[model samples]
Target: MNLIGIFGTSGFAREVGDIALAQGYQPLYIARDQTELDAWSFAGTAILESEVEIYREIGFAIGIGENAIRQKVARRFAGQLKFINLIHPSATFGQGQRQIVEARQGMIVCAGVRFTNNIQVGDFGVFNLNATIGHDVIVDDFVNIAPGAHISGNVHIGPRCWIGTGAAINQGQGDTKLHIGTDTVIGSGSVVVKACESHSVYVGIPAKKIK
Candidate 1:
């Protein structure tokens, strides 16, 4: 009977909806406005009223500079807010697994190192150990990252992109998704100098599009 409302309609929000359903929560997608958010009436004591302590436990950080993200998350946290933590059943966390140095709701983390807040991770994404991702990183859905990959701050990765082992992108700066296109494969040990195209294969130093 617990209804979870997801705030964005695109990308991360959509993925969060899927994960919410998988976890047996009634997931509802809401627009970026609070008027629309409050209009969706609940018949019972809303989780929003009871989950303030939980919200205090989690935090928010958007990798992009768009002011819209801040506005939306701020509205959600205006009163009491509830965040979600969604880990795959097969994923390992804490001691011998990915130690949860930070915790939040609507997260789909696989085995990895410490994670902080304000990170927008896409659905069904996997992170291997010794792999480091910095703050404000926007990871798209279905991203498959190999072990030992070091992604730096303010980086944006597009949906369904595969980051190869030891492959590194821009230390998460500039204006871009760092833009790894959908279904693209990055060969192991490759270095991506520029944003990659969708469904293409890039390899070697500077990661040229070979396929």
Candidate 2:
């Protein structure tokens, strides 16, 4: 059986291992240091990162949930290891028999996530549990959609954005796309009805810039 190297030693790392198990591949949990190596929850599955040996066709994934850290890890390992997309079994792509138009590698699509048609997803992104994406959405690299977040149609999300838990982004009307600039943060339970600025934090009912 092929082994997938999962970087990180947290509970989420083990959750990613669950995806590997569901896909019938062995999950090799790589620890950053001796402390994590000793504290890893899964017995016989953990190994020090320094002890990693690259095998032909071996795949790697970042099990961490943060967008910035994920991007950092992906960059550090780029061109060195084969990146993989881990889609959970219960996730659905597209609605009404439609499908995602395009997707890239190192994407972690968790259980119950849904993607509507004509969505273009970039590399090394995470779609957390029960998150939904509507049609004509363009998501950039290293974006993280937290659990239960809902993204409506005609939305263009820029790179390294964090869409917090249960946030809802409203759909743009006919030919108008709500643009979320790069490095933005949409706070938890917030409703986004307008375009968001880059490197800012938005929160509240009609998301106002808090930072």
What's the C-alpha lDDT at position 9 in model 2? 87
lDDT of every predicted structure (CA atoms): 0.55, 0.86
TM-score of each: 0.48, 0.93
* lDDT for each residue of candidate 1 in 1-211, tens digit (9 for 90 to 100): 3566555444444444555556566655554455544654532222332333543533322211122343445455654554445543444332422333223233444334444444566543545445666666777755656667766666777766778889887654565446677778888888887778888999988889999
lDDT of 1 at 70: 32
Show the colliding residue pairs in model 2.
Answer: none
The window of 10 residues in a row where model 1 has the poorest summed lDDT is 59-68
- Model 2 earns a TM-score of 0.93
Segments in model 2 whose C-alpha atoms lie over 4 Å from true places: 54-56, 95-103
- Each prediction's total of clashing residue pairs, residues at least 3 apart in sequence or on different chains, is 8, 0
